[model samples]
Target chain A: MIELHRVSKVYSVGPVKVPALREVSFRIGKGEFVVLTGASGAGKTTLLRLLYRDDLPSEGDVEVLGYGLVQMRRSQVAAFRRSIGVVFQDAKLLPVRTVYENVAFVLRVLGTPRRDITARAFDALRAVGLSARAQAYPAQLSQGEAQRAALARAIVRRPPLLLADEPTGNLDEAMAGEIVDVLKDIGAGGTTIVLATHQARLAVALRRRTLTLEGGRIVKDEG
Target chain B: MLGFLVGEALRDLRRAGRVAVSAVVLITLSLAALGGFWLVSSNLGHAVAKWRDRVRIVVYLKREPPGGDVAALLERVRVMPGVAGVVFIGKADALRALKQVLGKDAGVVDQLPVNPLPASLEVTPSAAAVTPEGARELLARLAVLPEADDVAGSADWVERFSHWQRLLTTIGLGVGFVLAAASILTVTTATTLILHARRHETEIMRLVGASEWTIRLPVLLQGMMQGLAGAILALGALVVTHSVVAPRLEPLVSLTLGLSQLVFFTPVGVVALLGAGTLLGGLGGWLARAAREP
Candidate 1:
């Protein structure tokens, strides 16, 4: 479902050209739960951004869900995005909305029927163990609970691919374990998951295929 | 989709709070000022038209002409190119007309030992000759008449009134433009504040594949609502102003210009004012959205 051939990313800051990814290539089949581990500035975020087609590669090709990122138009990018979900490090839930509304927002964007949205949003919240806090606003939630709410929002649309970039980066070890278990359940339900993080021990304990990035290149791939 | 868009718009408007209220107030003020000037200009235009139609050239004879000569001169003036009608006013008849115009002040006029008014030919000009250029031409012709000592008319005053009407219109437009600009800026600022406050939500929306319009339509609608509210308030204010002032001012207007009643905006004017307000708000919202980082 995903492929990148020697992809490289260079960001220009003033007169300097900084490389984020260099000649990196990877592939993940459908319904796989894969973890990406790297230190800070190891290009984990850039790799995830490329997979979501948020940023284009300076050199080489990227293919996600059979659409060539380089050739995609703006309309196609939007259409492509509907089939994939992203979870940011900060969770990025709307502070003004309750947890249920935050999850239902994705369904609303997809124009699901209100009746269906109610059922599906509740189910997604249940999966994340956030159904009890459905009416709680993001500001009122604990960091772990907010991340879980963000997870519910991400999966509300039942996207085929889920890309999480350090979703538990700010949580305690216990909270991180709980969040990862929820992600494991989501993966068991057949959604492909690509989780990027710098937590080496958590990545190993998850017991999934792990890819390590160091200086924008894949240093190890353990299937 | 429509319900969601509209619901989000209303929510945004509610969230806008003071900024939105201030925007409505600004719009109301802008449109009120605009409508006020428009009303003045309309009334002035009516006065100008009435005065133009009454424009005439008065030829003052050197002395009372013989009856036959008076008849001959009247016939000649009536046949002139731009002359609509001519009435010969004799000295006694002119004095009687003056007494009628002066009302209770006629006793002061009657105290004069001698009839000092001039015997003149009151020359009414045709519609085509009521213009500044046409009136000037006709006046020049009347001035050279053999029986004329001096010629005078209200044409100059009519022309001045017309100039004042034009000037009022220009000033109204200038003020309207400035106020509209201010309103647009205020609305833009309000929308930008909302944008900044909701930046996180917007980013999440994009991540979840929300359409561009799903994100933007609410902001546009919020702006439109502000504009519409402002226009409605301004219209309300205008109605109250007219109602309170029109009755008291009606007699003054009638006494001076002989108009039966004061006028307000026609239905078309009301629609245009509301449309202008809405457009101003829409423009501000659009600018706010355009300035957002995609």
Candidate 2:
């Protein structure tokens, strides 16, 4: 579950106060696949960051998985992050690790048993169609493969909620379609997904609830 | 998890390469400097104890007195508060001892027209009176004796040597402090380098819900390992140096200080040196963790 009421984010650069999100409010039920569409600088990433408690809203409340982000203690925030998977535009895989290790890293952080970790990581990679590339390194992967590896890493822990920020921003149309299909398969497995993207066509093709943002405010919500 | 933490730490050290090596070298230098001074101080203390046990004061008389007068003076010297024992060495006996000391040059001493050495009472001081202050007080009393013209004792040299030892210890402490600081900073620099190199890895770890300690423990272990390696190396260096130099210096040490041989660190000393190295490294890790990210 996710909830935000009248949330606003402001970034102060020098003497200027630049608003990234303005009193944006939204709710998504469990196991929903939701697309967040916005132009560049339209608060999609900011909203996702707020949901994960990466950055707290300047004003208003953000509730994710039953914890209030605005007032959560740092320890609580860390605990809260474990229940959710987040993907940045950059795949952010450790260059030194193989894809299997990268995905296993999430389970390892959770102190999962070594045997369980192998099983879970392989399963996650299989879901993303990356089990064959498990031995490959991040540097050796194509843009699509890297994104898939990042996806496998996120879902390996089987988080209740998944927030992806432009998971296909750098991919070709064909590769992007494949990533969307993989995401759809993940959502079908009942993990709530909130995917942010600047591509309206991707949002339309997914046939999910789409929330469009412009100048820091949500302007449309339709399926 | 313990295995993972330790493995990660070793891997980090390997990744650290030159910076880690620098840290180890710095630690070795610090511990070696400290250990070297410890050895010096220990040997000096042995010398001091040997000399203190043999402390003697000589009251040189103007001339040998008559039989009754000599008996009275010897009795008076024996009754002094700090006099452990007294032996009267007459002029003829002093000359004989001088000839024995001169060894191959005994003929030169005999060529003199008459014996020039004075008759003296060799006063062996009590344990308490062997100290510089106590010896000085005893000398003052002996100097006032009617039969005595001069009172000579080894107290001044003992006092000066003790002072020199203190000075050396103080200097050693000051140098050890500076070197220790440099070693800690070197470890900090190396840990910081590892932190920077693995910043991305750290962020990923945090995202995957790693505890703060889980992320930090490896870095701390790496620092400690560097320190430990350095201490072992320093101990090895000290052993080699002592072996190579102790034999050459044994004669001089024996001749001057009455010590048969110079020795390396004791078992306790070795443990302390190693422990200090480990502590310095841990301190560096703590400092690195405490510093804010720029």
DockQ for candidate 1: 0.56
**TM-score per model over all chains:** 0.85, 0.84
lDDT of 1 at B256: 89
lDDT of each: 0.90, 0.89
| Model 2 spans > 4 angstroms off | B57-130, B138-154, B292-294
lDDT by residue (tens digit), candidate 2, A1-223: 8998999999999999999999999899999999999898898998988888778899999899998888898877668888999888889999989999999877776678877988999999999999999999999999999999999999988899999999999999999999999999999999999999999889998899999999999999898
Interface RMSD of each: 1.2, 1.3
Q: How accurate is candidate 1 locally (lDDT)?
A: 0.90
Q: What is the DockQ of candidate 2?
A: 0.46
Judged by DockQ cut-offs, the docking class of candidate 1 is medium
lDDT of 1 by residue, B1-294 (tens): 778877877888877889988988999999999999999899988888888777768899999898889889999999998899999999999999999999989999968999999899999998888877888899999998989999988477777878989999999989988998999999999999888776776777677777888888888988888888899999999999999999999999988876678899999999998998889888888889898856
Among all windows of 10 consecutive residues in model 1 chain B, the one with the lowest summed lDDT is B198-207
lDDT of model 2, residue A27: 91
Clashing pairs in 2: none
